[model samples]
Target: MSRRDSLPPLNPTRAFEATGRLLSVSKAADELCVTPAAVSRQVRALETFLGVSLFERIRGGLELTPAGARYLSDLMPLFSALRESTEGVMAGAPGRSNVLRIRSPATFAVRWLIPRLASFHRLHQDIDVQLTTGSAPLDFRREDIDAGIQLGDGDWPETHSQRLIPNELIPVAAPSRARRKGWKLERETLLHSLARPEDWTLWLKFAGFSTANTNRGMRYETSLLAYQAAVEGHGVAIAQKALVLKELEEGSLVAPFDMTLDRGGHTYYFAWPSHRPESKSLKAFRQWLAKVVR
Candidate 1:
């Protein structure tokens, strides 16, 4: 066989790269947007081609053998260089220059990012940002997204998370409702978001209040809906301060409590794949986010 015939197939190499980098087949599957079984099959194929055990099971988790680790080390720079070359070519193509595709959580997009986006456009008119809303994990290989605004402690696997906003929790209510009912926590109905059920409990604990009544409240499918309910005077809602800043300033929502719960580590961040080259559009957007959040 020719020397080229001995090389592993491209799919198996990619599968091995992802699995070896993350050290978890399931996580690698998530990043690749494939099933665990498929990832496992490709990994096995690569192992057979290499004629060496790539990973070993220890305590029901994956651990890379010495051979696998060495092989992965050699592959990392090659993959990185490949990514850079592809990005460079695509960037120079006509009509694609300075265009950025990004993802963000729906609530944060609507409440915070979208509202501030006009300023960014005014500052950097050359860059085009196409924003989509979702909290799903980012997969640069499987998706066309350039970056995402995620809520986390910047610990995402194979992702670089730049913190944008600190998540501080506070209870908010309509001004009329607070005025009429005095906004007492024990007397008022607690509005809750199905997405963040622990916000109220967390805030209550921070404020030295019992969490006994946190479960008794109206629930909405999302934090945005809960905020709307609070605006309409239905009930008091726990809000991340950053999301409610405009409403608070506009007098649509009133925070009766003096206390705020700073969610440790979990904050709004601008995240992108760690392995990919940062595009011009992404750099402009990241700079704008930092400036606005300041």
Candidate 2:
């Protein structure tokens, strides 16, 4: 048999590559849309085929073996090159313009985009917007995503970035929570979204309250989780007022204080690669977003 025919399948190689790149089988599984067991098995099979240990267990997590470290150092550049070549081919392909992918934070995707998506659809029936939600910054050139709504200081170095909205954050809780606990704004157990640990402290400072434990709270990673906790009467959360506006209008949550903090330190921005073709659909979507925010 030839050397190429003796090698393991490409899928196993890909699994090993992703696992090595991320250094976590669970993360590799998430990225590949496969189960953790599957990723683990694939990695083990690859290790057996190569006759070397690729990873070692450390503190209940996986770490690369020295061999794996050297392998990854060699593989990363090739992987990047492959990604660039694939993107170039996809961009040049003809008759493949039915999808638009967008990356945004999970909370923003759930609370803001999902609610107003119907309107976007009504206006532009041709474009289908597929959302990928994560907290990580996207590489527009490497990924297949057409555009992204990013939350950060507007300093994307090499993309077309437009400010989507300026946000003000305030303390909020479910009406039930407020009613049942008889909790006024000053006496509530603060629940924090991990994205903004100092949110409660800043809001408290804005409200002229200088308590020492202003930062004490149940912390969550996403605003969606924070909102869920607040709705279940767990604790009060400091959230972007705009994100919770619909819930506030519907009385699901109430702002205990009228004070708002200027989070101009960061803002939401819509960004796309500067080199990509700007289609009519993309232009329409941008214009609609501009009008909605205005």
Candidate 3:
């Protein structure tokens, strides 16, 4: 290729990068300060320029194609470097104090974090925590978020992670449902979350039960939805113990069996890019999280 033909159009390249990283045209557009249609057009332009399909439309959202993933892996570092260089030049600019941006799983944020966040606010009145909900893999360089809460072993590459909470799984049902005659795991309707389809199987195995069939159930788009179904006495649902504490404590939901599955290596973690210097807000947040989790 000639020197003039080496690089793709900057706008299309940016649109594709953002879309590929975020996996949503609307989200990419929001980040780019453009319309969703514009983002879509730019992505198409880039795809046409490269002569390859970069994304596949999935049921609920977009999924990167194998080629797209590989391409994104290569493009991310370049974009990160560019952004870092730009920020370096713009350093010392006036900025807000102690404003922290955080991304977390929707259910966790709603059920656990938000409830306890007021305590953190009272403790560090100077700090402002802006929480966003998402369960996608974190790319600190690509995303504007300062920190993210992830459910994993804290092994994400180039991320500094601190364990936040143990992920314990237990089968729970509405009080009425649990007390109903003929209610048993082997017979009651099993509620499943599409996000964690294997949860039931994992819990069942740990509870010394056969993992033969966990597929027959009413599947919801999220754990929150499945838990709601359980709360309505629709079916028995496997729940992350931390996310349903209020329900359990308030007697809205009850665990019939005496078994709890500590989901091995998987746990909630507070993570951020290791390369970035830790800010006062981050330190305060981390310490507050530690105190609360304990």
Candidate 4:
């Protein structure tokens, strides 16, 4: 038999592959949660068995040799397949209920979901929700996300989306800021939320104050930041009603004017892949969400 046929089982091969792909024994060790020396020893053993030098030392990091490159390319697909199969089996199993991964915008997750999560837990005690915040949209197949909360028009292609909240923007400021500046709505410095650039203009128009300068002010990327900025007496912010309701109720934020705008686009939406129906846990959570939001 050839030496390759007489080689040991695939554990050492996997270790080598992980180390080669990461290009650092330390990183591989971190992923495996073992010491760097252990990873180094495993890689050395694999090199001795294969009779090939797999990596070259560089200035700061290790670079793969030609042999190593070829080896990694061949094994990558195998690892990916193994991972997919394992995840598929785990996801399909009825007894083992893993976490339901959810992706959402950071501001929305922090301001909206995090506060209400306790109620969800109370309702569905068995379903564990794992939330990851990002600005980028998620690919359901590429990411193992069970559901997502998105802010946009209800027209996401190839996905099932349910409208969670209506779109309403209003001008709000910190109570301290309002108190310090006196209730002079016309002289209030505006803090802008980046998601809705035209919110101030629309709100101004709705309030019949068409002459106010809506474009000039400090801008923040998220409502959470805008809320914080307003609370710090920086400026007044145009905020979504759903996001600021708790703050308003608690006297942290105050809406001095009754003027509000009902923009047609940009509503909160609950979404998931259309092809994949919700699991029982996800369904229960979704139903609970509908009840709470309604």
Q: Scored by CA lDDT, what does every candidate get?
A: 0.83, 0.77, 0.85, 0.77
Candidate 3: where are CA atoms >4 Å away? 1-29, 32-96
Best by lDDT: 3
Decoy 3 TM-score against native? 0.74
Query: Total clashes, candidate 4?
Result: 0
Cα lDDT of model 1 by residue, 165-250, tens digit: 88999999999988884557888889998878889988988898874588788999889999999999999999999889889999
What are the per-residue Cα lDDT tens digits for candidate 3 across 1-294? Answer: 754245444498788888987789998877677779988998898889999999999899999898898998788767766754555444434553356889998888888899999999989876778899987888786676778998889999989999887889999999998998876778888999888888999988888879447888799988999999999999999999989989999999999999999976798899988977777678889989989999
> Could you give me the TM-score of model 1 versus the true structure?
0.68
Worst lDDT window (10 residues) for model 2?
A: 2-11
Say which candidate scores most in TM-score.
3
Q: Candidate 4, which segments miss by more than 4 Å at Cα?
A: 1-96, 180-183
Clash statistics: count for each candidate: 0, 0, 0, 0
lDDT (Cα, tens digit) per residue for candidate 2, span 133-212? 88888675335467889888868766887787677988888887777656566667788878767777887888888764
Clashing pairs in 3: none
Cα deviation of 5, candidate 1, in Å: 37
Error of 4 at 26 (Å): 12
Model 3 weakest 10-residue run by lDDT: 88-97
Candidate ordering by TM-score (highest first): 3, 2, 1, 4
